[model samples]
Target chain A: MCATCGCSGNEHKLTAFLAMKKPEALTGLTVATLPPGARPGVQSFAPDTPVKTVIELERDILEKNNRMAERNRGFFEARNILAINLVSSPGSGKTALLERTLADLGARRQFFVVEGDQQTARDAERIAAGGAPVVQINTGKGCHLEAHMVHQAIRQLQPTTDSIVFIENVGNLVCPSMFDLGEGRRVIVISVTEGEDKPVKYPDMFRSAQLCVINKVDLLPYLKFDVQALKEYARQVNPQINFIEVSATSGQGMETWYAWLGL
Target chain B: MHELSIIQSILEATTNAVQQNGKPGTVETIEIEIGELAGIEWSTLEFLWPAAVGDTLLADATLQVRWVPGKAVCSDCSSSFDVRRLYDPCPGCGSHLLQITQGEELRIKSLTLVDKPTVAKAPLRWN
Candidate 1:
């Protein structure tokens, strides 16, 4: 209906802009090679030919994702499934904690893990060793997995009645906080090796998380990490956050971690 | 990272809309309204759209993303300010308990396409 008012014509005239196809659906990464254009009748603004003021982005990039996420949440709710998203910096032992969790809970309950990373099926393999259905989402260059991405990955994952799906998001504390993968609980994992200042440094990640996992507790003796300070700062940012301190390697503190997972 | 899949959902929705409207010869552009605090990354969405479209019916379609600002209502002063600026404590009084109203909607508002000009008593060209 030419809703851009008449701005489409202006976009067509951009300097040697490569012809592009608008996507009907997207997965990992979706890039638009062109810029927005202003059209008449419609108030949609467009980039000028040579110069223009900074475009004020009025679109919420996550809108479509939330729709699919809502659908997913509904599906999970109908089946009484609990989905937990695990976020952390690299080597915070997300997989390890998950592995321990599955080991402790698999006999009593069913659990699955959907691993997201820029590369590698390694985490998936590790979880598979933990005796659970595992799905790996290789984002390539992407830092987080959107709901649609998880939706597709869920198909490959073996579904169970009242299942718990733990999504190990990409090894980033920043970008993953921006995207919602339709999980009920968001758990941020941090390791003592990364130092205690992480919670203060990455407040957004901690603020967005419903739970905080401090992994590699056994190594506390070797490092200069202050567990007490980290916990305090994390509490300051998120007062009601659930904290779990564990050593996924030595198996110490795993019982409490499992308890926190409600396993 | 996640935007490509979102674009896919938009495509699926629009394609259904277009088909229901009687398959148009070509699809032009899709207009969507995105609000802040929707927790989506615009740069990533724009960065991953081409791959999502590829050479489908939307191969030539345009993705117009409009950013919607988040309005925060100060619990103390009952004033509204932009949340992105982290408008500390309402200008009237210092209060951090702000309630965010609106600015979380992500939806397809409408679409644009070129069809045979509607004319009465004029020969209709299938082209």
Candidate 2:
């Protein structure tokens, strides 16, 4: 319908739509990053904020993310897929272990890969090429992936008999340990490239990990990583943690690792 | 890092609250209190908020944070003391057998949205 005597509304609309661009990045949010300043305890914005104002909303928005994770866990439980979350630094052989597991049990069991990275889809691409269904989630400038991200990624993946969903979290030794991704097991993978003191330095990551993977044993001879000392430090943090020494490149101890996964 | 997902959660809860309260329009602000030990970066949440709740009720809402420090209690003395995330041991007794008393909480206390009933300027009626 033309208003004002003669213009094609469709053309005008199309032109407007074509000219539309992505939203300009937000400003004024920089102030939000700072800690709350004490001001007799009231943080009133420019205008009156409606909805319950009797008290400060001491809420964690991640609550719903956690709930969604539980639902995903239930879904996995129903299908008998032991969802395992693997967190580690980059090049800790998280994908290498996956590749070997896929090679060993590709025909025997079902598996899927949920790869998370700040950028690049190479890991997911590799996992998918290894005969396992994989979904790549790019977290761009983000440090870690949460359970809800895994839930969203898993929804698109095809499920199969005795399936396993391995959520390879972003390479982070700090923040990833905090968020529970509804995994049956949280496996922390570390390579010899990182010092043996890593377990001691980053205890929270190792303490919460259900299993610790000491990967890249083939390079152990090439490096000075103390295997026994690393194991002892992990033991000090977590009295009882299942761990294994493996070389994904040489296929030295991958069988034991896979056996633990019941693959 | 996963604040994008967290933003989605805020939107869902805000939407439900809106339906219950019968409010309309975008959420101007959604406040949340995160424990220091909750391991969430305030900057990260702010960064991901827009992306996660894109054009939703909470799209432009401010994520107000309340930082609550962690506390641990002594099993021997039953006394509670402040605790740090990276370190172990109690500040009161210097004992490592302390249990977490508070500060590892990840819960939504409440949300703030525009109430339509209030906005329409209906006369206040006493019950």
Q: What TM value does chain B of candidate 1 have?
A: 0.76
lDDT of 1 by residue, A1-263 (tens): 23333454445322212112233332222223233443222122233332212222233435577788887777778778889999998878888888878887899888888999888899999889878988999988676778888998887885676889888898887767767778888999899988676766665577678888888889988999988888877765555678878888898888887776676
TM-score of each: 0.64, 0.68
A86: Cα error in model 1, Å = 1.7
DockQ of each: 0.11, 0.21
lDDT of 2 by residue, B1-127 (tens): 5555555656676677667665454565665667766666678777766677776766666766667788877666788888775346556665555566677666666665553222222232233
The TM-scores that each candidate's chain B achieves against the reference are 0.76, 0.75
Candidate 2, superposed: residue stretches over 4 Å from native = A1-60, A200-204, A232-237, B2-19, B23-31, B42-65, B73-81, B90-99, B111-127
What DockQ would candidate 2 receive versus the native complex? 0.21
Tens-digit lDDT track of model 2 for A1-263: 54422445422211001112223422222112112343222232322223333223444566665777788778888888888999988878899888988888888888888999989999988998888889999988767887778888887896665788889999888778867778888999999899887876876688788899889899877888888888877765565677898988899898888789885
In angstroms, the error of model 2 at B122 is: 24
Screening candidate 2 with a backbone cut-off below 3 angstroms (N, C-alpha, C), the clashing residue pairs are A59-B33, A59-B109
